[model samples]
Target: MAKLIVSKFGGTSMGDAECMLRSSEVAFGRGASLVVVSATSGTTNDLIALGKASESQPWAEAEKILSKIHSRHVKIAADLHLPTESMQRLETLFEEMGSIAKGINLLKDCSVKAMDTLMSLGERMSSVLCTEAMAQVLKRHNSDKKAMWFDVREVLRTDDSFGKARPLTKEVESLSQKKLGFLRDYKTVVVTQGYIGSTEEGMTTTLGRGGSDYSAAILAEGVAADVLEIWTDVAGIATTDPRICPAAKPIDEISFKEASELATFGAKVLHPATLLPAIRKNIPVFVGSSFDADAKGTWIRKEVEDHPLIRAMAMRKKQILVTLSTPEMLHAHGFLFQIFKIFNDHKVSIDAITTSEISVSVTLDDSTLVNKKLIADLSEIADVQVEENLTLISLIGNNINHTPGLAKQIFETISDINVRMICLGASKHNFCFLVSEDQSTQAIQRLHKKFVEA
Candidate 1:
């Protein structure tokens, strides 16, 4: 069996026919054995909206969205000059989508199960289109072998968790061997859908939004591939979001630990959990731009040659700070446990935490998904103050906690910005603080100049 190279392309890379052609070149030109593709840009959102409308809006309204989605795909297929049989197959998929929407309207309820199935359609459709495009590109180059569409769900089995399913690792490995093992000796480029998995019962589920990267890592590890390539719109991971700070530069190399911190702190380039499988397998991961394949991108591995004081900074906006103050919390041992237990029971993930003798402040992402009952329960233990529209700024590095002068520089740079809460000692790699959302960009730029540019 030859060493496999698994490459994953994000939605923007597969946005249209031209983009698909470029992505195919990246896959085949770079000697990728398997290619995992996300949905065309905006297709998943449209599908979700159509699903929501099925529950409340009339069937006609949902059909309108379905028709729009179908037309987009049809146009792309025609633009790519796909065969008549392939175009008919594309229409068949659109027909299936219409039937699914009609069923959702008739039921008047879009369960998580139904939504996952609908969302899976985006990847399935995109995979079909990409395989055709890549095959054409291969033939044009006079390659004897063509790209093949491999159904990933056949091997990437997971639990019954419909919306955010957890992949069963052992099952995935076994199935990958049984199904993808043949591809090891084959000489064709295998294209598959990302973010979609199936349970043992064969019910379709999703790993979550941005799970396509996770899907790629899973396949690479499952098959023991040499390297996992994540092709996105940007050149690679940057010191900060380029949009927030235009001076932000791309990082050539980073450690897995630092990359994980950046992902957790709100870097959108890679999913936070995408590196777990690759990390365990010791597979080096590459992040590059599909639009500009020749550009130098970031490489994530177990170690890097250099470790800077502040490698990168990330800011997560729309944070909610929950401050609990009570005399009982003063010098109390079990008080902290009680508060944490409530968060655990509610399944709320905290981004940052700071504590005083009599109070504790925590920040969580501001989302409607937060459990209201958790807040109501916390109010019983202590007086809770909730602050909305805040931002979390994380300075990520290597052993920055013990590094002197770094903290001094950070404070001096953002001396004027009001810091709400500071969280340290949680991880050796990061020093995070909360601030008003409006000041986040200014804070990032000042910090980037002070640390990254200097």
Candidate 2:
């Protein structure tokens, strides 16, 4: 309703009690921060792991599993001396999570729909903790503390699609305006979570991986927030994976389009879908470090200076390449229709696709959950091969297009490494290639040294 500042902190940003304190400090450092947080360290995985393990057995076993996870947060609150009301809400959340786990166990099958409902607790629990922590720390340090635990589940609505649900925009906007309807009524801080949402029927849902960042963006857009600060573990988006490209430098600023490209390519710092809402609203999103609040980090915006090509590099290791070779693809019109229809029926998303004479090669994220039954259908028209454990390296930048020797420079650097496949003219500004998972890190290092570093 008002120009609020919505900040989203990742798991690493709120990894512990200390990180939570630092997140609040970062919030206060910038006035009127609306903080959104992921689960406290390892909470999501713990919850999911329990959900999977509990499906085969009695509900009580699953109930105990979740009780352990709940106690960890309880201990942190006890250590911090959280106020009465917040702590009581947390107790209520644990009860809900426990009940949900039992339900999953009774169901015996953890469908994506079921999993989404079970896993919403990650954000729900963390929001309660973060809100309480913010209240205590801000009251103590900033001396002008005003914070509330905001329920995004009440506002960030989505379909009942479970693991990878699309946001229900109209409902979410209306609910957000109503729930956060008050920021215009007053100046305050609100803490919430990323990733999870609820349906109109009150069913719990998750907005895919990195959904929390998207949540932050949507809230910023809804409240007409001045800025969205995304707190993470790294030094903003990098030129390359620092693990591979040691010379990779932090980007001071990048465009939303560029940020989306980076997320698609390999920059795990921001979710691929997070930028659209911010871009639509023309709100600036800042990615900063949770450890050092003063770091300039990176700002994703609408404009950029005369920056160099290849702003960053992103690599993903878990992949499978399905190369379709058939004569029908050579001169066929909309032959792609047949190829896509098979994937669509199976609900598989092709991460990267390239076509040529008599062949179409697709790189799919491993989590698309493909199986041999679907492959049998594809083998009808084309020869199918599944290249497992490959890594995708995407060179990302605005001016990445129409570079004459850029491809040459890249290949020359990795001339010796066995490159599996390469795709250029990748959209407006990316050139991606698939390499052996083993060589991914080395290939990135070599590319950075040759093209990026002095």
**Predictions: Cα RMSD each:** 1.6, 2.2
For residues 229-296, write the lDDT of model 1, one tens digit per residue.
99999999999998888889989999999999999999999999999999999999999999999999
Residue by residue across 269-301, what tens digits does model 2's lDDT show?
888888888888889888888787777799988
Mark the regions of model 2 whose C-alpha exceeds 4 Å error after superposition: 1-3, 58-64, 141-145
In Å, residue 53's CA in model 1 sits off its true spot by 1.3
Candidate 1: deviation at residue 202, Å?
1.0
Clashing pairs in 1: none
Number of the predicted model whose TM-score against the real structure is largest: 1
| Backbone Cα, N, C clashes tallied per candidate | 0, 3
Q: What lDDT score is found at residue 170 in candidate 1?
A: 90
Candidate 1 residue runs with Cα over 4 Å from true position? 368-370
TM-score of each: 0.96, 0.94
